[model samples]
Target: MKTRFGKLVCVCAALCLLLSAMFAAGCGNDAHQKKIALVFSHEPQRWTDGAQMMKESLESDGMAVDLLIFHTDEEQAAMLTQAVDEKPDCIVLAGGDIKNFRDSLEKAKEQHIPIVDYDGLTQDTDAVSYYVTFDNYGVGEAMGKYIVQKMNLRTGGGPYSIEFFSGSDTDSNAKLMYQGAYDVLNPYLESGQLRVPSGQSDYAASAIKNWDGKNAEARMKELVANHYQSQPLDIVVAASDGIAYGVIDGLAGYGGTWPLITGQDADKKALGCIQSGKMAFSIQKDPAVLNQKCIRMIKAVVDGSQPEINDVTTYNNGVITVPTYLCLPRIIDKDNLSAVSK
Candidate 1:
């Protein structure tokens, strides 16, 4: 009887220990669970895909993620403020006018919530902890170089009529891209190899507000009607696929042959355009790669370790030089369309 009682007690103790272990495993401690807030200024397909990928990747790693998207600057500022109040471990920001977000960024800074500036948000503030984006200048340089080689600018080709379309005025990346292209093309313009028929060569004159397709479309139509009515436009330097689409739409009404157009962001529609021989070439900046880099940075911040960065002196946010990881963009044309289309 004594032996039986002792064995029963041992069994009960074993059961209690197993139950305790199971309970602890089932109910994960909240203290160790990291949280991240992802904020985007707009819901363009690219941004949408990036947000979804980031959310899934972080969540799969046992981290909580809050995905927030806003349409306008005001909406973004408010969303940022709200995210700061929630006190996530880190904030990943993409696409938005950074001027309106200064106060909210400051608040996040005060709260010790690191901000990962995905893509180029602003170069005028040091509120962000890290930045992950493609080399915008290089993207533009690729476009310019492509045009130069195709047009044989180096071999003293005849003067070609060209037009330019830049992104929104608020985006620093736009300026950087414009500068890169302009630096390459300006010499040609000065040497009479390329001429701007519309006289809209400067960024201030060529910028499309909000990078809106409609605005770009309207501008293109106006330029065609006013300037390209007589002279044929040989080339168009569009800063993005959205602007490129606008240029295409603006030219659709006219019966003129499509000019050699250059664009960024190898969007599916733009790739289709390339396949159809409507667009010349586009710069491919894969959002998946960029988002993965951002996830690594966020995880580093959560783990209290130093995140990996490549370029340090390139991105100057006025207050301090932001540490950045630059992903290189590639040109996608009809020859290689099949590779990226899949």
Candidate 2:
């Protein structure tokens, strides 16, 4: 009888231990089941590369990531809708406005899911969770500073012609970048240190539709034909590398003295151009670095902590000021570009 009791006791203890192990696993499953959705505009290679980095990072943290890529505005809206229907814990938007995704993002509001904007902003609304991007104004300011020094705009002692081309006005970064460039160069323009003989210097007037290089090239050609036919153009400030390519192409066709040109986005072709002395500089906004910052923000959100927001007053999404983490951008010129190549 004692042997029988001992065996029963052992069986009971075994059952209890088994139940405890199962319960612990259940809790762990709940912890690991947290889900996030990554949405990308997918048009620009930069955006796609950044999104991929974010996805890999999130998955490494043991959370499931649903990466959605959309090409058109309508596709973006539909993808957001579908993502919300999945009831994800959070959504990361690479680029686009809340207006295009209003219906779906409203569902996000209803579902209590937060949306993080990466490298760009959507329309201001309660749905916006956090914002991360480079100091866009500073980016253009860097370009402006480089241009001023290269062209001797500050002390050139006379009117030097400069042609300006901005990214699409629809882009928030483009607007801020143009504003930064204007803040620096406008003073020179007003002080008569520089001139735009083509009179195509207005940011609004010089905006590149869709950020297309062809459009920019066409404008560059027009400017060269109408204004620089007989004289050397001192400088041309392009907001992005694609636009810079167009501007350079126009310069090449004009067959005149090459001007000191500046651009953002260290694109391979642009970097080649810089190496060949066709372009002066390109801003290095490393996609992998920006991706890591976004991932850190996501982990913070998931851990129920505030993300590492560095700026609170600068970026307003039209509804309210968004808490932002701005990354400083670096310049890639002939002097230090070898480091990048290595």
Candidate 3:
């Protein structure tokens, strides 16, 4: 009986060794080296900055990342198709047109490859596994509220002249943001507290094509030539800081008082403008928190673990509602500018 117990102990030790070897070969070393593909339809400053943050975070986690950006929709589709063929651990759609890559993304879904939408919210949420972005409406509401407070409309009886310049019509966030501003400023419009000297108050009507600064500049010029030439405008709600810069340039050509401008995304140029009193303030959406959450989700999905998602109903990407995580936006002004700029 003593000899039999010794043999049993030897067998248990051998089994433990085999399990340790298996873990080291499969989950331990292999899972640490994950390959990720980041594909973008366009390379905007805000987008590229976020991409850099994601790349650094992933690389720090021992991930191999492929960052790709395209100028045309067709280019985006072809590249996404090629990425699907490469079969990286996962593919990140780093801000792009969803309609452009829906088919290729579906192919990925069929192959069980995970897809992440990093700020490019499309109507086709079914093609994406997870969606993440700042609360766009909240960003707009913050700007509207700030403008209202700055104008002192609560106590002042005068009607302030204002113009609204929304971002591109193609961007889904643009609509939500404008709608948020409209929700707050509409009451003032009805009460005759806020007036549009340019008479272009509709969101759709004032949308900047491509969100191009040149186009925005042209529109501002037109607003001046048609309406503000005789007198300086009081306020202009520029949706993005990029658009605000253009508005500022156009106003520079004006012979009247510089108008108050509101913007989102605390880009360097816009921040400088705010410091110089050209712009009022901006809402900043920091990418650090979002990128960290993104890394967590990617790690879970790659390791065959389910990720945590909070919003299941707010975002419907045409085909199906995709699981999402929403990040709140923060208002940035002179009070907090040093924290970021300095």
Candidate 4:
């Protein structure tokens, strides 16, 4: 009877040890999970897609992600402050205006939280560790190159009347894109092959506030009424699809052939317009490519490894040169629309 009782006591002790070990393993897994804070300034479809993809990808890697979207600069600043207070392992920011978050970013720096600046460029570099984006200059160059090829500008075929519509002046990417387009078009403009009837070639003159389609539409109407009444407007270098659509709306009842237009962001409506021959082409910055790069970078930072960087010299955020990964953008036209759609 005594031997049987001792055996039972030993068996119970073994069971308790096993249960404790299992509980410890569960807590270990929980401790290993990383947390991330993702913030976006706007809810455009592309950005929404990016947010979803990033969340899914990070969660799949055993990380917890909090997504925050804001509409105004003030709102974004507040959101960033809140995110910093949460003390996540990493923060991903996509904002049109970065200067507004200077104080919040400083707090993030104090807490040693890594920041990945996505899409939008910023002047704050001390806290921003990595930058992931499609090549803005390349996007502009593609647009300008498409216009040049279509207009036969290099082959001396264009004495075309062209109008320029640029993105918001506040966006750094907008300026880079405009520069890329202008660099390609300037030679022709100097040679009189491309004439700006309104003489608004400068970025400041052509910039649309906040990239608003309505504002672009209004400007397009004013330009058409003032300058294009006699001569045909042969080409339009619109920096984005919104601007392109505005140009299309402004020209609805002008009773002339549609001009060859260049735009960025392969918006669905813009693609339909391309198919119907209303607009020329647009540059598509694939969100999946950018999101994957961001995920890899975020994971690397969380794991205490150096993330992959392709370009380090191009992106200087006022304070320091940021390590950057640039994804190339592709041109989407009627001929290649089905390929991209698939």
Best by lDDT: 4
Reference-based TM-score, model 4: 0.90
**After superposing candidate 3, which stretches have Cα over 4 Å from the reference?**
1-33
Q: How displaced is residue 114 in candidate 2, in Å?
A: 1.0
> What is the number of backbone collisions in each predicted candidate, taken in the order shown?
0, 1, 2, 0
lDDT (Cα atoms) of all candidates against the true structure: 0.87, 0.85, 0.81, 0.88
Better of 2 and 4 by lDDT: 4
- lDDT winner between candidates 3 and 4: 4
Candidate 1: the clashing residue pairs are none
Clashing pairs in 2: 98-123
Tens-digit lDDT track of model 3 for 1-342: 889999999999999999999977887777657888888655467777677778888888788888777788788888889889888899888756666877887789888889887765766556678877778878888888888787887776458788999988777778878988888888888889899988898878889987777889999988888988787698888988888988988776688877789888887887887789988888887777777777788888889898878788866766778788878888878877888853
Q: Tell me each candidate's TM-score.
A: 0.90, 0.89, 0.85, 0.90
Q: lDDT by residue for model 2 over 1-342, one digit each (tens)?
A: 999999999999999999999999999898768799999987568889888877887888788999999988888888888899998888888777666888887779888888889888776576788998999989988988887777677676557778889998678788889888888888889988888888877778989987889999999988888888798797888889989988887776576778888888897887899999998998989887788888888888877888998899988877878899999899999998888853
On TM-score, who's better, 1 or 4?
Answer: 4
The better-scoring model by lDDT among 1 and 3 is: 1
Candidate 2 Cα misplacement greater than 4 A, ranges: 1-32
Model 3: per-residue Cα lDDT at residue 19: 93
Candidate 2 lDDT trough over 10 residues, lowest sum: 150-159
Give the higher-TM-score candidate: 2 or 3. 2
**How far in Å is the alpha carbon of 219 misplaced in model 1?**
0.9
| Alpha-carbon deviation at 203 in model 1, angstroms | 1.4
Q: Alpha-carbon error at 144 in model 4, in Å? A: 1.4
